[model samples]
Target: MKLQAVLFDLDGVIMDTAEFHYIAWKRLAEELGIAIDREFNENLKGISRMESLDTILRHGGKADDYSAEEKRDMAERKNSHYVSLLDRLKPADVYPGIRELLLALREAGIPAVVASASKNAPQILRALELSELFRFVVPPDSVPRGKPAPDLFLRGAEEVGAAPEFCIGIEDAQSGITAIKAAGMTAVGIGSEAMLKAVGADVVLPDTRRLSLEFLRGLLSA
Candidate 1:
């Protein structure tokens, strides 16, 4: 196999926590008396939970005002809110075709691992009951730097006993694509085809729905 493993981004790739994150951030922003709409939440998607907090704080002009204690308190509260909403993420919410894709990877001896910037990656995986499929998980705390830096995916590939060139990184956000490419690996975007392509993903699929192994092969060949 040209690809020895697949490294997936957690938030939007495997777990369907987009709306959950949106609602949590919206509620927190509102409680802080900040203005946050759908667009703001969309921008935060696929980022680490702490990174998401920093984004919201910066957007609200509260980053400068927040003391170290205040930032910690806010991050903790956001985690509380996020954990409360994770009950919505059941096995039923695992992305379309994900089961088959994981099975195929395992059968072919291509280990799959999650490389996310989210501190909540473990919770999400536990909720989906798909934890067993992964060979390793490199969560936010696993790296000193997050996406757009390439540290996360590089570490994930190493942890899975694979080279970056022999691994495919699946992501949706533009920063994620940039990180994957910077890590010396090809990328398969997991969201809208056109937008993903515009970001220069090697393979762009609307979703994981009709995705196949041949599609993955074609991406490697191209």
Candidate 2:
């Protein structure tokens, strides 16, 4: 039950960049004459940029309208917009207690790693002033597949020099929980308990602000 590392998803788990992502995507969708709302944006969580574009097109019933190259261009445009919004980020943007948890993990010899589907993960971490906290970051391009596929989480565990079974994956999306389980790691979902339980998360908490070394150790031993 020894937990050697904690793999975190950057967006909702580390900082609140979900809205920025949504805004970027929504703006891109508008350019394509497709409307996007927050509910639809939720589906983009834990998915790659291109995959998100695909989802957006599908939701708008226009998946076949754009060629692959056009979709690539659209994804790039969305990313540019997203990056522009990143200038608004500050150290205070980090969720309460997240810094404490990272410090605690480091003090206890446990590495913390970022395993995010965002290609801009490193930049976002820097913007949030959290780039130095992680042992390593596994961004979208680091893995061939995104969430629910296990590759990203597995890479995170490897980067931290831990076996999947000895790692704890903290994520706020169901796809991320699926990926964690598929990687044979312990899943700690940071959202609704019932929803996370339905996806087989080992533990569920309202947020990372609620996590503590004692609580994590208990979960690991349980």
- Count of steric clashes across candidates, in order: 0, 0
The count of backbone overlaps in candidate 1 is 0
Global lDDT of each candidate: 0.83, 0.89
The residue pairs found clashing in candidate 2 are: none
Question: Per-prediction TM-score, please?
Answer: 0.94, 0.97
Q: Tell me model 2's lDDT, rounded to 2 decimals.
A: 0.89
Best by TM-score: 2
Model 1 bad stretches (over 4 Å): none
lDDT of 2 by residue, 101-142 (tens): 888988998899988888888888888888877898886786
**Cα misplacement distance, residue 117 of candidate 2 (Å):** 0.2
